[model samples]
Target: MIEDMLRTPAAVQDAERHTAHNYHPLPVVISSAEGAWVTDVDGRRYLDCLAGYSALNFGHRHPALIAAAHAQLDKLTLTSRAFIHDQFADFCRALAALCGKELVLPMNTGAEAVETGIKVARKWGYQVKGVPAGQATIVVAEGNFHGRTTTIVSFSTDDDARADFGPYTPGFKIVPYGDLTALAEAVDETTVAVLLEPIQGEQGVVVPPAGYLPGVRQLCTERNVLFIADEIQSGLGRTGATFACELEGVVPDMYLLGKALGGGIVPVSAVAADADVLGVLRPGQHGSTFGGNPLACAVATEVVRLLATGEFQRRSTELGERLHAGLHALIGKGLVAVRGRGLWAGLDIDPALMSGREACERLMERGVLAKDTHGSTIRLAPPLTITAEEIDHAVAQLAAVLAG
Candidate 1:
């Protein structure tokens, strides 16, 4: 009877009945996951091509991260950021070092991190940059998916994310994605920051022009505006680089990092910046109760250490080249086009082919689990720890679906 409770479809039905209908998830229910593979309750195994939206960059239940979580659990878990714990200082310090910055403000999820960044940018605008309080604006790119919070959603260019959500938060300006002149023209005296995804993941893993980031960095510097890179989806080794901005030898003033920061075990995210900019906050200005809990700190610490080795980045780079080549090889033959960087890709299907959702359902029927984004785009972002053999297997499954 207890085993019956473990049935995936039953659990899924219970969830649908109990939870909100915000997400239209796949039918398959993952019972157990490891590395790049997840097993359903029915004992069917599938390669997790999506990698939990790049949160599992270290892979599911990574041994080092899990051990860190277990060890922390035995000691202490949460202190509510009331007085602070032994792990907070070290965690913040590690994140600061990784970000190549002098300060960090920890948060729980990607949305929360984005919110925190927005607040900081606003404050910096008013207090530091001396913009009119309410007139302080943040420039955001169109087609950006920063997070799901109300304030975060206010600036979204997507109608689905914006419609029925207003009256929207004010002080946001939108411009076309990847347009340097548009971004430059949009910045003004009241503008505090220009936030962008170094590589848009949710919006079909959209890669910007080669010089976009570097150009943005230059523009922000010349205009005395902060260049905020929302690395929430594209950072932490997901793009085969430390940060996608690194591809152009540019470093943004502020980094909104999440997803893989907690090593797929817990929700841990943070905003990192240099001292003068982040030093805008004083005591009691902003805080999160569970921002730097011991458990999240421990796991995230392991995540940072793993990233320092460059192993995952190397793996993603090697596998990504093969993947992109394989996918583009199918272009015009099956796939309309392939767009993305590293292991994350966006496959635009031919008009005659099925929609991305339909293709996902078909892939589910096979042994590979991929999630679709826009109507025609199927996103592929497997774990950095996945083997070449698993890569081949996933490609074969995807190619078969394309052929048929």
Candidate 2:
């Protein structure tokens, strides 16, 4: 008891003393992780249900990714886009092929990719679509969580993310999510792009109504507005497919990809689009220093190869059914609603029973690590590599926590 008291507090206090309170992270301080599990500083093991917000879709320290990072570290790390590295072409070509796009502009984070997409769309609006200069408006949906950039958060519905961050950037139209008619009404001659998450991940894994994505695709096609799908959190096997748009048989004009693209190793993000759209940017218009570094490219290339096998997607589909079935059984017991696809889920815990934060804290005490969203919603995005037994274990823990 004395040792337990000493360890957790000291670690927590040291962390708090050094870091800014930008995030109210759970009390557990993870020391190491492997596959679907992580070990805290106290040496207690916990099943990682959040998977770094789907950034670790390949799981912690995957062998192929680690090997790639190590090999590249031994050879070369960065050349800063000024000169090309050997790992650059293959990574770009493979990722572009995976995305089925003519070009890929690599960046360092999801927000950068989103920013890149906006720039490219605006340029395309002026150069190709013949919209007036500096008047290109992009239509976005409500409850969107694209990124926390000054420009990206300009349209945020969340007060916490948006409040006091302005003078906000302009030229974005916000409409209700999953409302096709509102989206249609919002887009006009000045609209350059319609930016959306194919499945809203940060917004409690909310899936859009049936045919909404397809309808959006059709509308974008008919209206000459570029459809930019921000797949940073919903892509790369998180939704049981290469991209969530595939679930609706809809293909957007551009894919903003990140998270798992880095193989849980480094920050890697990119915007994938065909020639006509991406070609609008001349050489110096947009770029990043560490965007396509040698180390990042090597790790992400292996990540692409792993996805090419389709094994992870298959795993997510099969085990996701098992996961949903287990969570669905607990609906009336403690959970109120469950929504998601593949191995991703958002469980709305009965507010009367407990807040999502309290439930997650209890689950942490019982050897499971998950993240809470909003007031009563908790997101579960276990690695695609997780086993059925692990899924059952996590659900059992949830049940135990709720029963108390």
Candidate 3:
């Protein structure tokens, strides 16, 4: 049994043989998962704390999402933007109502949603705001992780995601995150929008100052600029609220949503905004082949229905307190700091003890799976379905790992 546990499965070896070497995954090759736990090929059960970077927020193969997908599969799948599918209107209406927005443009990935937001903002500037055709600019914060598209990476501050990927796209200005003065100074006549994440998940789940989001909302309103909140990773109840911006009573002009929208079944993303802001685009101006496909819409509509109940958000809030409390108690023992909201947390381990990668490997060995971001920081985002006992078990494993 010990020898089998130490052996790397042939599946793990074959997986990386043909694929792009983009990701450095942990050693475990999972074969099955249910709720908060996944079983590797070796039959080892590990509590999943990463939750597919929050894409599995509803947990793996949730019954409702699965049933939706199964039902849609039997009826129809992709009709594309060329023809409307039966599931389209219901999804668009449900998601738009959830966002309190008049219109929604669905896409297949977070990157597509962000790209859609940028295009909409630029067109709105050119047509409505009367900015010059080629001169409209958008302001983005430093340390943002929007996506890896060529145009998106143009303004990225991360060297790894941005390096050698340019001749970059232009018309974006960078501002110090959470600094109202810096953000205000960065916005000018050419600025059409300010794109930001309410909580920077990839940047170790960084949350800004209390009033910063409201200040941005006000600044955008005053300057006639669109405030585009990139809530791909931070939204959908991961932050204890429907949207993290709701935590501070701030509402953005547009919302770029994805990640958990498909409920771990398929890729679903959307840009939500009022008709006035999203109205700038004509039919042929922009679209996607598989955006709002029947299967995606069906599954995502159920995801919206689940969120409508507020059960997941409530779970995140109550369970988050327990999770954070357990993490906070470990500070100064081996942890340097902890930051995040809801069931999401970013832990800064003592660099003197181990690198974040080493820490994650140790945790995996102890049956808890997590992902590390930068130098000594690791992120914890378990499914909202996780229970108090599960949260306690995860925290205890971390404490044991730290103690050793």
Candidate 4:
């Protein structure tokens, strides 16, 4: 017991000493993980509820993904964008088919995908829409979390992300989220696109009001502005649907995808769009050196194949209903509200009982791991592989934490 107790704190201290203070993670020092569970340095296991902020939506080291990565390691890895690799065409074709789009521009991270989308939208505005140069603007929502890039963080509503990150990039207009009127008013002649998350994942998994997404689609269509859906955190079966926009029967002009696309193995992200919108780029217009490499493509191709089977999506849908029901039952007891779709949820615990951080720390003690957002709100996004009994166990642990 003494050895175990000393090991974790020493490991944690060593980690803290070397890293930047960008994150305040839980005290638990994880040594290894599998689907929906992780083992700490002390060999104690904990249910993984956050799923690497939805990056591990397929769970840790999925068999198919791991196999693909292992096979590719022995073969070619990178060819840059200069020369086409053999694995490129198949991965792009499969992902484009999954998105129902004509073209896919692969990147290495979600932020890169978002940046690519923004650049494409601006180019489309100048070439196709004949917008005045330097006047092209994009409309975004408040409380949105796109990425931490300088341009992205420039328009961020969060002070922690935006503050001290200047001189900020201009040309973005922010409006209240879920308010169609405000969004419509924000767009004008210079507006080139409407960038939004159908379901704001980082914002406590906040699902916009029903019909809000379709409304935005209509507004963008009527205004002749591109609609870019940042599905980095909410897509790839995280919300039961292939894309959260599908839940509303709406389709955006461009889809920014990441996270689960790598299947928890490597960094992979892409932008999917129809030919006309994405074809605006000429040779040398935009590219990534490591984007669409052989290894990334191989693993991502398997990831696409996994999604094609539809098992994960089905699991998310069926399991989500059960999870939401359990969360709803706790509303009066300790939770003030619960918001999300599919397996994703943001639980607002009663502040009178404890802050979200305290609740998560308590949950960590109980063998379940979760993350907190705005002060009193905790987000739960377990892998689709989680079983019903595991869901019940997590909920019961939360109840016990609240009671204490």
Which of candidates 1 and 4 reaches a greater TM-score? 4
Candidate 1: Cα lDDT at 83: 81
Candidate 2 least-lDDT 10 residues:
1-10
TM-score of 3: 0.98
How much is the lDDT of residue 40 in candidate 1?
Answer: 89
The C-alpha lDDT values of all candidates are 0.89, 0.95, 0.95, 0.94
TM-score of each: 0.97, 0.99, 0.98, 0.98
Residue 371 miss distance in model 4 (angstroms): 0.7
Say what the RMSD of model 4 is: 1.0
Identify the runs in model 4 with alpha carbons over 4 angstroms from their true place.
1-5
Q: Which candidate do you rate higher for lDDT, 2 or 4?
A: 2
Candidate 1, which ten residues in sequence have the lowest lDDT sum? 2-11
Supply candidate 2's per-residue lDDT for 3.
Answer: 75
What does the lDDT read for residue 353 in candidate 4?
92
Over 4 Å off in model 1, which ranges? 1-8
Model 3 per-residue lDDT at 397: 97
Q: What C-alpha lDDT does candidate 4 achieve relative to the native structure?
A: 0.94
**Per-residue lDDT of candidate 1, residues 1-404 (tens digit):** 85566577787898899998887899888789988899987888988998989999878899999999999999999999778789988888888998999999889999998898888899998889899868999999989999887898899887877789988888899999999999999999999999999988888988988888889999999999999999988999888898988877999999999999989988999999998888999889999998989999988988999998999889888999988888888887779889888888999888588899989988998989888887978999999988888888888888899889
> What TM-score number comes out for model 2?
0.99
